[model samples]
Target: MKNNIGNQSDYDERQIAARGQAFQLAYFALLGALLLYACSEGLFGRWCDAGAAAGLCACPSVTVFAVTCIWRDAYRRPNERPAGMIALMGFLAVVNLALGIVRICEGDVVQEGILTFFICNTAVGVMAAVILAAYLLRLLVLRKEREEE
Candidate 1:
């Protein structure tokens, strides 16, 4: 009887964790694909190969690990906040924006198969930045209200 009563809360926590994992995987897939596209032999220059490889393989792997760790930390330690996850998202947005600009400056972004996908990356970056900005604004407003109170 006691176990059954507590099962609902446990079930809900499992659901939230499951959703977070799914979101993490989806984010990885999207960023991985874009990095692969950018690294395509004929699309970008030789200088970009190392950077692209780092982004495609190393970066995503590290990011996923970091996020999973943060999530687990929160799960295991209730008082711990999700500030790391928020920082990760903002960092990713900045990385995307930087990659987009690097591609554009390379002079090959508008050429051949790179044009459409490069634009897509830029657009995604812009969207991410907008979301980050919204989060920042909300945080600032809430802080101000707390101070006023």
Candidate 2:
């Protein structure tokens, strides 16, 4: 039988290089965020629950990776259209934000002077929104460049 795995060689050299750099940067960002989280917790005390802490550590690296890929024009496959992805990100942002707001209104986002797991919904929403915004901004800049050229 033929190999069932993907070709894995579809990405061109530039895309591969860009992705490598993005991964490196994202890794550094994740390390820094985790270090900060640990230091903050050790110094000031627990400011957020585990879920929120995880979001705090994860969001920055994800954003860095996505933004880097977007700027490098490597966020999508060469044949892919971004409209569907844009719509999906928008939907995720809206849903998470709505849920987060509901949780806040219900007084479920914080307890005993520390943020609870419910706050992670807001963090996830914010991260998605930020990535969406970056992607849109990159698209706009590319459009402008194309128009000028």
Candidate 3:
């Protein structure tokens, strides 16, 4: 009976560890995808009409990348993520939230020209906000559950 109980405990620990690892992997994957999207838009371009629009579109992607990378690093190696990273993520999250609100507020401008452009960008920002929030929530829940064990 003692051996069986010990084996079961060992199995449970392994399962928890695996879960933690899987969460980190998923966080990194999300960060990578967001970074790819940011790069495709040429982030450092001159601020012209198209460039400004592209920059706006890229904001959420950058935010997603920043947050997810911080989260992944923090999860994989607890207490290893630098304070700067946490600060950066917090800053980016606030900026993105403001930008998303601005986009929604200005949505009426879509009727003027290139309706698809406005629609697509707005949709992207909204989706990014939703996804980022969901990811953060999942991370918090997982972390809490891990701690309780």
Candidate 4:
């Protein structure tokens, strides 16, 4: 019990927990937005793609599960969480970040004459990217702590 929470330069559980809580809140909020979008505009626009909706629903749910595992201090245990799930979440986070960059730079997020809020996919993507990144970093720190232990 001699201050084994990892190096002082690195973050402790409180920091990780705070970040996880933020991610959980953001994902839940995103879930709500997705629900509204699916109900109102239909997944992938007004075409009402049930297949897409079902597939997309898994993102938030799985992310929540992965983030919760990190939040609950499961990194130290052997059978607490699947490595594949964590890896999948990491891949998604990196992809989301890249896609957000592409959308903002190459994609014509601005319309012909006006900028609108509802059409701002790039912004939302970037926000989600940030959240996902924090989760990944927190996981990395925890894993490192486990290694040190």
Candidate 5:
């Protein structure tokens, strides 16, 4: 893509790279937000209410990351793998949401139990796995496209 201003011609490689970097940075930020919410509410509060609240906070990050990826890639390329990764992430987010609801409904007594603690920890594990898998999928797809070019 080329931009012209009077007699000057400019290449927009930096702009495209900046957009890609911004999208990746946003993804990283969303991941950090998810971790912070989990730690602050789930671990610190020791109540189902905390988990519910944290889950509410996390939902937006998932949505934002998915939409940002879609928008960033819209004009450039047609990559089905990123869409698949987003779909998987969306599925995992729904599972996490359901687990959060279950935790919230179980009351404070359940939250205090070792089994409940382990279950919540397991939910976190699932989230971590989803995040890692999505990141890897995105990296692999982008690398393959670059190689093709």
Candidate 6:
């Protein structure tokens, strides 16, 4: 196949297996979180709107998946350089965080004591920031290990 980036485009068996495990773990985490959210919402009226609640319930699972994949060394293909992906993630974090801050400043994050859908922007921004931090930390640790070896 013709390649624009690199010859290696697909993940190896180890990465695939790790990713499958990560997916399973993430799925279960999401289900568990949603269950807890449902129970809480049922018990104590609506604290947040549906969209904010969804974002709250979903961020942890996404974080779990990203962290698992990154720590397992399965986040990037063998020949992939993560620079572009990292830049994109950084951009997403900045934009979402800025927008979230703007909304909060404008007093749009909460309405009548209930969180609005605007909370999703901050949730997503935090998730992206967390994932990016994990990726960079792992990269640093790997580099240190290489230097030691």
Local distance difference test values of all predictions, in order: 0.54, 0.89, 0.50, 0.54, 0.53, 0.92
Model 1: residues >4 Å from true position, as ranges?
A: 1-82, 112-114
Q: After superposition, how far is residue 125 of candidate 2 from its true place, in Å?
A: 0.7
* Model 5 worst lDDT window (10 residues): 4-13
lDDT at 56, model 2: 77
lDDT of 4 by residue, 1-149 (tens): 78565765554666566656757765785688577756766444453244444434544555455456456654334334545655764565566556656655764434443333322343334434544565667778877999999
Query: Between prediction 1 and prediction 4, which has the larger TM-score?
Result: 1
Is candidate 3 or 6 superior in TM-score? 6
Q: Residue 126's C-alpha lDDT in candidate 2?
A: 90
Model 4: residue 56 alpha-carbon error in angstroms: 1.8
Query: What residue pairs clash in candidate 6, if any at all?
Result: none
> lDDT per residue, candidate 5, 1-149, as tens digits?
55642221322454356566656765776678767766866666644455544544454455445445434543223323445665666676677656656665665325443224324433553564556464656667768999999
Which one wins on lDDT?
6
Instruction: Note the residue pairs that clash in candidate 3.
Output: none
| Positional deviation of residue 39's Cα in model 2 after best superposition, in angstroms | 1.1
For model 5, what is the C-alpha lDDT against the true structure?
Answer: 0.53
Give a tens-digit lDDT track for model 6, residues 1-149.
55554346888788889999999999999999899988988899888998898898899999999999999999999979989879978998999999999999999999998999999999999999999999999999999999999
Q: What is the lDDT, from 0 to 100, of the residue 91 in candidate 6?
A: 92
Candidate with the larger TM-score of 1 and 6:
6
TM-score of 1: 0.42
Model 2 misplaced stretches (Cα beyond 4 Å): 1-9
- Candidate 6 — which residues are off by over 4 angstroms? 1-7
Clash tally for model 2: 0
Order by lDDT, highest first: 6, 2, 1, 4, 5, 3
TM-score of model number 5: 0.34
TM-score for every candidate vs. truth? 0.42, 0.89, 0.34, 0.36, 0.34, 0.91
What would the per-residue lDDT of candidate 3 be over residues 1-149, giving only the tens digit for each residue?
Answer: 35543442233544456555655655666566556545754775422245345554455555454345434433233333334534544565566556656765877324433332344444454545554565567567777989999
